[model samples]
Target: MTDDRRRRGLEMMRQVYGWEVGDAPGDFFGITVDHLFADIWSRPGLSMRDRRLLLLGVLAARGLNDVLDIQIPAALANSELTAAELREIAIFLTHYVGWPLGARLSVQIDTLIAEHERKRH
Candidate 1:
């Protein structure tokens, strides 16, 4: 994680997710998106959006559906993946990951959108 991207991720965690940590505890090595974004996403070989799609694939393939539900949209929002792009990605996943998983993701995204809307309301 470059200092700049690390700083940005931490700031976003605090501001967006209300995460709290001083010097982040050791338990947080790569438990969530921070490490991936700063370390893997910043790699010269991959674009941020491509990295996000990769992560999304990993999360889905590993049956990390709960985490994917949150990370997918967060990745979209943070990594410049447009909603249409995300929808297309999700569609592509159904063929590999099955309709059930894709449907669950679609529902989860809807839930995230509704929750955000409720907060705004």
Candidate 2:
């Protein structure tokens, strides 16, 4: 069951992030595969799109900047989110997550959007 779940998670992750589970080194990467991807991500209640949005919001609020580097572009490339929606989310999160963090997120997302577009051509 664990293997199946991991495989499914990897597929989903690749579909969204274009990243492989083993692409990076660390126990945390393993946990991301086993727990985040295999466990939470495999749950059926939320659509993948909804989950992506929640992940983005939570990571932004927590100021998980590096993780956002990975997720922001993936969400845009996969069409899980739009540039406008991301901008809106940044504004929405500002009141709750703080202006500095939310503004940082908005800028990063804008940069990633440009990168995503460049890659498509």
Candidate 3:
């Protein structure tokens, strides 16, 4: 049923992003929840951490720092990655993604790590 799928999608979204689902209006949101989260993200074989690492690489490669802003924090909250691991990811990715984008990702990672540390302490 549609409602069941929506519910599943919402739960998946929360699991993936640490986000609380609300009534978001729009076809795009509908598809994102119903299809992307429910169908795609909920599929088996890959762990959430694996999917996140792949996504992080894509986001970093494309220099999508805005999206990374959301993902990196979710990754931390989800315990999918640590601050040191994230920094290492940035460094490793820099060799492939090039310096400018790597720097951008590094800066974002550093900022988020500092924020996470501040919250913890």
Candidate 4:
């Protein structure tokens, strides 16, 4: 059963991040995979995109641009969000999260979009 959960979690990690994932390396990552991904992320209540949007809001509000660096690209690669949609999200977040973080998000979005396009071409 634990193995099954780990396998499901690895798959969920790949699906969520749009990247290849491997077995967890440590206790922290084990929990992240075996529980966070397998159980929480696999829950049926929300679509992946919806969960991502919620996560983005929380990350932005907390000024966690570094995490956004990972999430925005994954969101783009997964087709869960468009560049324009990201820009709009940044704009909307400005009202609630303040201008600095919003600006950071906007800039990060632009950078990630360019990077994604470059990698594709």
RMSD of each: 4.4, 2.5, 1.0, 1.0
lDDT string for model 4 (12-62, tens) is 999999999989478999999998999999999999999999999999999
Task: Give all TM-scores, in the order shown.
Answer: 0.63, 0.82, 0.96, 0.96
Q: Any idea how many clashes model 4 has? A: 0
Candidate 4 Cα errors over 4 Å, as ranges: none
Clash pairs detected, candidate 4: none
Alpha-carbon lDDT of model 4: 0.93
The better candidate by TM-score, 1 or 2, is 2
Provide the overall lDDT of each model, using Cα atoms, as 2-decimal numbers.
0.61, 0.82, 0.93, 0.93
TM-score of 4: 0.96
| Per-residue alpha-carbon lDDT of candidate 3 for residues 1-121, written as tens digits (9 for 90 to 100) | 3999999999999999897987487899999999999999999999999999999999999888899999999999889999989999999999999999999899999999898888879
Worst-scoring 10-residue span by lDDT in model 1: 14-23
By summed lDDT, which 10 consecutive residues of candidate 2 come out lowest? 16-25
Cα lDDT tens digits for candidate 2, 1-121: 3667667767766776766644455677767876777777778899878988888889999999999998888788778888899888888998899989988988988888888889889
Please tell me which model should have the higher lDDT, number 1 or number 2.
Answer: 2
